[model samples]
Target: AQPQEGEIIGGKEVVPHSRPYMAYLKIKVKDRSGSKPSSCGGFLIRPDAVLSAAHCVLKVTVILGAHNINVQEWSQQRIHVTDWVIHPNYSSASLQNDIALLKLRSRARINENVTFISIPRSNEHVRVGTRCRVAGWGDTSVYGSTTDVMMEVDLKVQNETLCQQEFHDYQRLSMICVGDQNSGKSTYEGDSGGPLVCNKKAHGIVSYGPSGRLLPLVFTRVSYFVPWIRQQLRRFALQELPASPSSQ
Candidate 1:
């Protein structure tokens, strides 16, 4: 049987706002008039910047914070997206360098329900079999309907050799593989651009996996892109910083 297009396999519900940095990316259809909104997951790395998958950026309307898709709550804050930055070398065909940044029109206020997550240091890499957490509001089963509440699952970093076999295009230096061979916990549809956190640091960005079964999930290795991420942040900071008054 063909695996369902999107959803988590063998995962549990997560407490609302527990993962404060998580951002819900909604793609609005301009002409569909009354069509259901399509969504993807993202994470906040800065007050005004959201890290997400490049593929999810097209026609994205807004970033919802303290979000739980199924309900309207006082904790929810919506920020319009002002712009976006995609990696220069991102490849749609190979899904390499599959990361992007969404610039918020206004900065998000930090509070208990809205915060940022730290990215792994440039030289850091979690050892194989290291446990990590991935959270999102995606489907609960293959081809199953998506959930309104968020979900989280534990996965272990897999061996490069094993991952390479499963994902023929897997590039160890640029990608990290994670999955639970025993529990079958993996991210499916609607999870792209979400964080793979280890030791309270984001080590990967949910990239892709087999469409049907929960075998090995590939992510954009955060450590490998630290330099690029820093460059973007620095550029934005410089642009937004007030210029010093020139001496008369």
Candidate 2:
């Protein structure tokens, strides 16, 4: 968890191409020495926009229509985004406001193998205990090798009060606490920047968790940022925004 690489360790393989909106990311994070390649997951929200975690944004290449990322499957569409926007108030220290939107250089050609997921309406809310699932490719056990095949795990939304006690910085209005308290069987966090889908809508975004081990996961509550998302989407649709921000 120490801000080192984080991905899921184990999950059930999802049917290939079943989650058409999935976006596999290849990222290079530059440091004083150089950079290192990292991976994360995301989801298509529009023909030209993808939603992901702010911390995961960088020199990113997105692969859509991917099931087996290891193989250049026929359905894949690799793309570089035209723009990236990390929430203005994003914080590395606290991991607050950890959401971002990316505009594609080219509109995605939607098909059975590629499409977009629905974002919640402004101010809409998901209830505690609501069942949801997160999907990605790299969920595995510690010391387990990363798997290229997409995988997913089912989870349930938890009470905010518990999260408040566990994470001193927890913000109920902006973040969601997820995992199963009974089984602790669903602390899936590898799909950072991936969607927390509930009833077919993306209600949350994979965000930071405890640095080293699996605990209940936290997600950026997408409902709280619907206004901002819509504003950015309008700009992306109108082509009126200034130059995109970098690795921001």
Query: CA lDDT, every prediction?
Result: 0.81, 0.83
Error of 2 at 69 (Å): 0.8
TM-score of each: 0.90, 0.89
Q: lDDT, candidate 1, residue 154? A: 86
Give lDDT tens digits, candidate 1, residues 127-151. Answer: 9989999998777776566787788
TM-score top scorer: 1
Tens digits of per-residue lDDT, candidate 2, 1-248, equal: 22122334334778889999999988988888899878889999988899999988989999999998989999999999879889999998899999999998998999999999998987788999899989986556545446778878788899998789789899999999988754434434357899999999999999966655566789999999998988778777667446654221
| Predicted model with the maximum lDDT | 2
> What's the lDDT for residue 66 in model 1?
49
Clashing pairs in 1: 3-212, 4-142, 4-143
